[model samples]
Target: MWISWMIIAVMVGIECVEAGLNTLTKVAMTSGMSDFVFVVYSNSLALLFLLPSTLIYHRIFLLGLLSCTAQILLYTGIGFSSPTVASAMTGLIPAFTFVLALITRMEKLDLKVKSSQAKSIGTIVSIVGAYIVIFYQGPPIMFSQSLPILHSPSESPLSNWIIGGFLLATSSFVISVLYIVQTWIIKDYPAEMVVTLIARVFVAILSAIIALIVESDPKAWTLRPDMELVTIVYSAFLMVTIRSVIHAWACRTKGPVFVTTFRPLGMVFAVFMGVTFLKDTLHVGSVIGAIIIALGLYSVMWGKAKEVEIIENSFICRINSSSEEVPLLQNKSIDV
Candidate 1:
């Protein structure tokens, strides 16, 4: 019970961290930090924070490279496409992760099992709810007069929506792969700090290589002691390190399916954060969609809890049976 709740708490924390990351990344881009440059700086700063720690695992570097590749492709996809499409595509992460987990034998696909069915249905509901909130914002249902929220102006969709859609979908799939592979790796390594550091180091190296090839202006490399600096520093230590450690621990303790299921919750968190910081309007669609998301989250949690309970029961039964056999064997030896 405690472990389940801990995983839930971690998921909530992840959502909060992700929401802040999205907001900060947007502001950084607005401040002339290209996606490539921001990735380089953020990952470099993260690596700096991680280098002093004792390293235990090297295999995590490969996972780190995959993660970095996904981020590069994802951000670049957003650049090629519209933010609308990117946001919508992110809802696919959990679905893709679920599929990969099944293929990798990390997750059992038993449609007849109640837990499995619940998990499957919950995933679909969450995905639907996320898209509803993202793609269709209805009129304001409620508005606070104190702090007027300004919905950021929407830009026209890219002409090559098909190409952009493909890029974003591919990026989402890669990210899903990262989630599964990272979790699988953690089962053996089980060193969260080491994994975190390796991930950051590799991401920094990759992002730096990409940044050099693309960003020519030396001024773009310069970081003023402003929001840009704040974004880099805060995102590096708190955002990357803390979030990565928490995720690695969760993936180690739980599974990739559990870790990825929380992605939809990010949409919920982003909505509230937007209302608070961006002072965005509270639309009816937002209200309904959030409720649906909450339902899906609850369903998923219930299914996961049931799965844990079943495992624990089987384990307890095995222990009891083993103890019974031990006493019988002891009696037989005494008789002999």
Candidate 2:
């Protein structure tokens, strides 16, 4: 019971960290920090921390490539949209991973089982909630009259929202694929830290190259001594290194779907961050969608727990049956 609670707490903590990251990154970008440059700098700084203990494998490059691509997409989306949108889009990950896992045969589907049925229902519900958040904007709710320092214009253009939503959705899908591949790699290597380090190294190199090309002005790479520097360091230490290591460990222990199950939790955290720090207007549709997403998240988590319990009970029954058979054979041999 304690272990289950610990897992839940840790997952919640990770989501909080992710929401904070998005908030900070958005603030820094609003201060004129190039998204591409930010990715390169933070990742490069992370490489320095990870370099102390490093092992290389050629196949791990794919992991790095995917990571870089996803980060670029996510940050770019945040530039165009709000952190709330980015967090909301993450709710799609479990649904995406569930489908990918089934396709890859990593997960089994048996509609007859209540657990599987719950998971299926939860996936559909989650996707519906996500789209509702995307398509519906009923009314904006303001918490305070004062505008935040980091807040952008009163309203972002609709085009930007559409583009950002598309990019964020794409990023989530890529992450789902990465989770599947990472799980496969971990099964063979079984070294979470080393795997993560190798992947980060690749991300740093690739992102640096892309940043150089996209940000032609040399001044764009220069970090200011203010929030720009702070965001980079925070992102490097907490997000790039610590978050990646924790996630890799979680993915090793629990399946990819389990790791992604907590994504909706980030929406709650993001809403808090946006309202307090960013002073982002809360929309009725967003509130409704987030609540629905949370419900779906709970349903999926319950289904996963039930499935685990069923597997464990079945294993215990098999062991008991074998033990009983052993005693019966011993009695038959003695009688003979």
Candidate 3:
């Protein structure tokens, strides 16, 4: 039970880190860093940062390959799609993880119970709330000239929103697979730092090669002494190595469902951060959507907590019942 609480606490920390990751990455990308190039640099730098771990427990290479593939697919999909599509698709992760977990027996789906029902409903509510945030951008109640400075000088107008949406949705699904795969792979490796390092190394190599082939302009890879450098260092060291190790630990301790339930929190952070930092306007839709997302996060947490309590109680009951019968059986054996 105490362990469960610890997992929850750690998950909150992970979510906070993820929020910063999103914000920082956005700021860097907005500064004219190509997404593919950024991916390669961050992953590569992360590899360098975590090379020590790789030296200690390096074995499997296939897992690293899958990790790289997933990363490539994810960023590529996001490049093609809009952020709204990406978020909406990400909302599908809990559902996808739930289903995948059940199939792999990583999660038990006892739908007859109230806890299970709450989980199911929580996932749905979270997705709906996310869509609300993404779809309904009402009038700006607060405009910021300083923060929420959303400047996309790089992106051109998308002619095919549908295509972009599909791409992003696909990326979201790939992310779900990535989660499950990571969970499975880590079980065998059992070294979170080593696992993260190995994956990052593989991903870095692949991303760099791809970047070279696709990006003809040599100037694209140029590292400026601005947000780009900051993002690269921060993402490599903090985001990849440290943050990923923590997240992988949480995933191993809890289940993927628990890790994914915080997806909605990203929107919460984005809304607030946009208004405060990016000089963006706060809309009514954002307010309402934030509320809904909050509710959904609560529901998931409640359901998981309830489920944990039930399991602990059952375990205690078994131990007590076994102890009680132990003396009785001993007396009978002595008489015999």
Q: Whose lDDT is greatest here?
A: 2
Please report, in order, the local distance difference test score of every candidate based on alpha carbons. Answer: 0.77, 0.85, 0.73
RMSD of 2: 2.2
- Count of clashes in candidate 1: 1
Candidate order (TM-score): 2, 1, 3
TM-score per prediction, in order, is 0.90, 0.92, 0.89
Once superposed on the true structure, which residue ranges of model 3 sit more than 4 Å away at CA?
1-3, 59-62, 73-88, 146-160
Compose the digit string of candidate 1's lDDT tens values, residues 1-336. Answer: 677787788788877777666665655666666788877888788877787786565756778788788877766765555444465577788899989998999999788999998899999998898889876888987675423222243443446556667887898899888888888788988888888888888888888998899988888888888767877787788767878888888888888888878887777777777677665667888777778878887887788888988999999999999999998999999999
Model 1, position 121, has a per-residue lDDT of 92
**Candidate 2: minimum summed lDDT over ten consecutive residues — where?**
145-154
- C-alpha lDDT (0 to 100) for residue 31 of candidate 2: 86
Which lDDT value does model 1 have at 319? 99
Ranking by lDDT: 2, 1, 3
Q: What's each prediction's clash count?
A: 1, 0, 9
After superposing candidate 2 on the true structure, give the runs of residues whose Cα lies further than 4 Å from its correct spot: 53-59, 130-142, 146-154, 283-286
The positional error of residue 260 in candidate 1, measured at the CA in angstroms, is 0.9
lDDT of 2 at 69: 98
CA lDDT for candidate 2? 0.85
lDDT of 2 by residue, 1-336 (tens): 777778778888888989999988888888899999999999999988887766555458999999999999999999999787898889889889989999998888999999998888887777677667656768887655534545453378889988998999999999999999999888788887789888988999999999988998999988799999999998898888988887787777778888888887787788777777766667788788778878787788788889989989999999999998998899999999
